[model samples]
Target: MLISFGEHAKVVRLEILSKIGEGLQDRESGDRNTD
Candidate 1:
């Protein structure tokens, strides 16, 4: 299985975005717990 450079870049970008999103969600939930 071979992916072009552009396709690999896109996959990497999506993985990073998802990780950031998960971190944000965790922070938001923690804030709610303190209130």
Candidate 2:
């Protein structure tokens, strides 16, 4: 259970990082694609 939870947390963290990266690129560089 502990290993599973650790893996789940890693996944969640990765998702959050991906979202933040998208936001940063869009907001800071006007690099967002609407398509």
Q: Tell me the tens digit of each residue's lDDT in model 1 across 1-35.
A: 99999999999999999999999999999999999
Number of the predicted model whose TM-score against the real structure is largest: 1
What residue runs in model 1 are displaced by over 4 Å at the alpha carbon?
none
- Per-residue C-alpha lDDT of model 2 across residues 1-35, encoded as one tens digit per residue: 35688899999999999999998877866544443
> Which TM-score value belongs to model 1?
0.85
TM-score of 2: 0.69
Q: What is residue 22's positional error in candidate 1, in angstroms?
A: 0.5
**Separate clash counts for every candidate:** 0, 0
The positional error of residue 28 in candidate 2, measured at the CA in angstroms, is: 1.4
The 10-residue segment with the lowest total lDDT in model 2: 26-35
* Residue 3 in candidate 2, Cα distance off native in Å: 7.4
- Model 2 bad stretches (over 4 Å): 1-3, 31-35
Q: Model 2 Cα displacement at 10 (Å)?
A: 0.2
